[model samples]
Target chain A: MSDASELPVGIADVEAAAVRIRDQAVRTPLLGSAALDARAGGRVLLKAETLQRTGSFKFRGAYNLISALDPAERDRGVVAFSSGNHAQGVAHAASLLGWASTVVMPADAPPLKIERTRAFGATVVTYDRATESREEIAAALAARTGAVTVPPYDHSMIMAGQGTVGLELAAQAAERELVPDQVLVPCGGGGLTAGIATALADRLPRAVVRPVEPAGYDDTTRSLAAGERVANAAGASSICDALLAPTPGELTFAVNAALAGPGLVVDDDQVRAAVRWAFEELKLAVEPGGAVALAAVLAGVADTADRVSVVVLSGGNTDARWLT
Target chain B: MSDASELPVGIADVEAAAVRIRDQAVRTPLLGSAALDARAGGRVLLKAETLQRTGSFKFRGAYNLISALDPAERDRGVVAFSSGNHAQGVAHAASLLGWASTVVMPADAPPLKIERTRAFGATVVTYDRATESREEIAAALAARTGAVTVPPYDHSMIMAGQGTVGLELAAQAAERELVPDQVLVPCGGGGLTAGIATALADRLPRAVVRPVEPAGYDDTTRSLAAGERVANAAGASSICDALLAPTPGELTFAVNAALAGPGLVVDDDQVRAAVRWAFEELKLAVEPGGAVALAAVLAGVADTADRVSVVVLSGGNTDARWLT
Candidate 1:
């Protein structure tokens, strides 16, 4: 295991990011439902990042990274590649900070997300998920426009910013006199999971942090098991478009590999059930990708009996019609 | 206007209710969205009571009233009549407090609500909405079973309990250094409306508290304008089944008549649009009844330009199929 000193993101960095994003991002509530607690057979606290600015926790990282840019870099703008949530987050954060942004998104990403990203005043470029590489398109655009390429994850600033969620979760849980035994977080490139694991290492050291992924896209799970990053096989797909990252980020995996618990995976059916449960019980509009952690909990992938578990609903950017 | 001393429910009662239900009820968050603010042309703070226990604000009043009952009354249990939200609220509250509950509900109430009410361990008795009197059925059940009758609204304790929403809203807004210029609440029997008006009257005296209702079943709106209680037409109907109170409650209307601003009304289409907007933008699963206040705001029924308005999403108990 890597020592704390070697970690790319630390508690102090997350605290600093909290201070920077305090005025801009939403301190979304840590919600509890008796119904959910009963179903999980444990004390369940939900970190509702679905209510955060731009409908996801991605805004925290986007804002923190962009805001830290030097004047010369800030004036040139930012570029990013994402399925949807990260795109909307970068677009909205850039718009708020008066920086131009360009986002490369998969053409098959949810229509609502594409519309919202554009609505946030960012230039959107679409590519086929099957054949084209969004990273290359974003890189080409950033080179041409002289904009800084803001990767969706992997950066120290982005990981630190997402760590604020862990900071808030621990504090909110403390207010209710709770010490979480486990925390389930949705994972794409593992930035949020790694960041949360790092933060909880200081706040609640004994708490187990688990990265939850959609079944076919469980690259993070396989990578963690293999003790190195691994890519998903070609043509594997799931309804959770936002969590289709081929592999975990290098910087993120370095932290998660040391601190996070065994990764968990849930299938599309489980994800759909979790989304419906959020709508019916929590009254939160959670997307399929965001509901994977919840899907894990509901599917009994974790031993929650008599324990306090915190589940993060990471984003809510989807077409309502898809739910029906 | 009636003096504070003459009111049946006051800020003190609401404060006491807040303390009584503090541990049991979910203190839902005051959420805001930049997208929503841009659309309203003002700062729009959403009081998300849809996240409240039992998925509505009704649980607050139900719990407060049942908890305040004497030992003998508690032993005998309680009976209530509701379209849906109130039934589930009273049932869950009673179940939590160890009191047996019997709820008389409209037969046409949403199937999900009926199922949830029963799931909460309440004895459910159905009455035809157009042909039978639920009040008489509940009164008779209470008389025969020696159970206390917990009216949906009319009682002072119930009003004060619902008023906790307003108390929390004002305090949350204050935390953000904002003083709401107006507050919009969905009105069924005026219990929640009067409760909030009373709370804000003390906390934010200058703020206008308006009750929003669906157009066809707008008894509260008509009653507020007519200077006397008025009932909707016998055949009047709307998709918002939870908000079809025939007329305002006696005690609730008395408080609302003195403290509330002009009532506002929105059509079913507007309410549907508001629900869709809430799902897409606010990431909240707001039911049609819960969306009326939002509908009024989105439809420009009130002047929101350059103002800070608080809109209460009162409940989220509806069939997902209806949303489609």
Candidate 2:
């Protein structure tokens, strides 16, 4: 297992994840709009993971991780730390597998998501963002309870599960006779971008896979440029609560560095504008974090070049107050 | 043509309309949520027409009507009168067919919808809701410009096109092996409800197709009870702007009276709640007007009877301010 861990991920990992998560994680639709196409100067297909169960693509990885746990480990339950989407995903996945789960979340997480996670039967442990470490709390809990710890994105299983998104999107696009010229994916710790890049490289060889980040939180971009894993500036934040990871995951960065094209960035204003545009045009509810890639498209980061562009709308757990 | 118009709509008409609109109109998906099913005490399938092209099922009817026009009539263009959804649909359809279109809209219609219709290149004529007749305005414009008047819901082509929603929903549900026990549709001029009822009766004979309307504009409910067509109370209005038709259409009402079950009603508050619920739970942006059937389900207007329930989320042209 250690030697295998040293090896880079392949399309086979993503294919296995798809089989593991089938019927459990939703196979979201790829939608399109003429208005978006006009703005991008090409056909823009939106793979709306917003419609996924728990309102994000995070569920695919979370569920895959939980289901892959050994029976004794699953019976001992699991512990995880997340802002919102991942929390709901793990909670719902654990509930489905009849495993007890404890999620350590930041106190400021969206109430709608907190309530939803609780509704899924996971015990929630809240911590202060600036003063406390959710990872420490979750680790301590796992130690005491003998529960398995499921890291959000660093693990191979998690990355492989997220890669299934690229697999599904490629097939769905091919079914529509659309071979994407570019695929823009929202990045946090680079897990999603890494997985998608690996899958797209195998499926759509001509497709350019790039990572999108918020302006001040462009750790992935800096990391890609520096040819190493890097961290976002401390104490910096954006409206995208779900995408505020401090640094790129070691394994994820390794995959993204080799497979991903260049990284792109969008400011908060552009993200908000994309959120409003999604409501007005695409008719999908996209959280600010999830809107970054779309914002990049609308902001011309990909420079669509009159070719077909595929953007992943990764999540939709926006606060009620943010809708306006 | 006149005799064909007099005949009640059949499944064959909807099937032919589907073929006509294959690549033109979007074939919307039937979605489901376990949380929603648990709340309703059974399974609840959502036919999300909100993601349809032009943001509503109205696109189907509008495109079907415009495409059926004779070559000479097409060259002369088309004129339509609508609250908003149908206006955008007709405007978009006309633009796609290389025809100029004019739409008579209410002065108080949502600014977002009005702007979108104009953006689709339709000429807009706004009139005071209290004292003006949009139909008369459209008729006059059609006569002056030698354009064909495309009535929003009354025409045979329009009804047949709208019925395609039922056809698509039935087929999608069948793919999942779900036979709906109750299919609840929002009622405006009753075209959608009538069309869906006709299609569902032929496809899913065990299903009960019901109409849902805003409380004050429950003309279809009153008409169904009275065994005759009836008009809404003069000057009645509700927040469900798209569902404010003065009365059911003659041909549409004929279909509904024969196939649909007793109509249900929900207040504006209930509609708003349903819209919010759709965003929060379904991760879909549903407008108030398009949420009435879901409102009826949430408000317990449809008891669901411990069986599979299907509700149509018909549009997603929400005003920005209303989202908050």
Candidate with top TM-score is: 1
RMSD of 2: 2.6
What is the total number of backbone clashes in candidate 1? 0
Lowest lDDT 10-mer window, candidate 2 chain B? B1-10
- Expressed as tens digits, the lDDT of each residue in B1-324 for candidate 2 is 123344578878888889988897777778877668777888898999998998999999888878877756567888999989999999999999888999999999999899989998899999998898887888889889999887888877888899999998999888889888889999999889988887887898788888999988999999998889999988776999999988899988888888886999999899988988888778888888899999888878788758888999999998555556
Please identify model 2 stretches exceeding 4 Å from their true place.
A1-8, B1-6
Question: Each model's DockQ?
Answer: 0.78, 0.68
Steric clash pairs (candidate 1): none
**Model 1 CA deviation exceeding 4 Å by range:** none
lDDT of model 1, residue A72: 62
Candidate 2 on A1-324: residue-level lDDT in tens? 123344367788888889999978777878877788889889999998998888998889989888888866567898899998889889999999889999999999988888988988899999999899998999899989998888888888888899999998899899899889989999998889878987887898788899999988899899989987788888787988878989888888888877885899999988988988888788788999999999998887778867988999999987555556
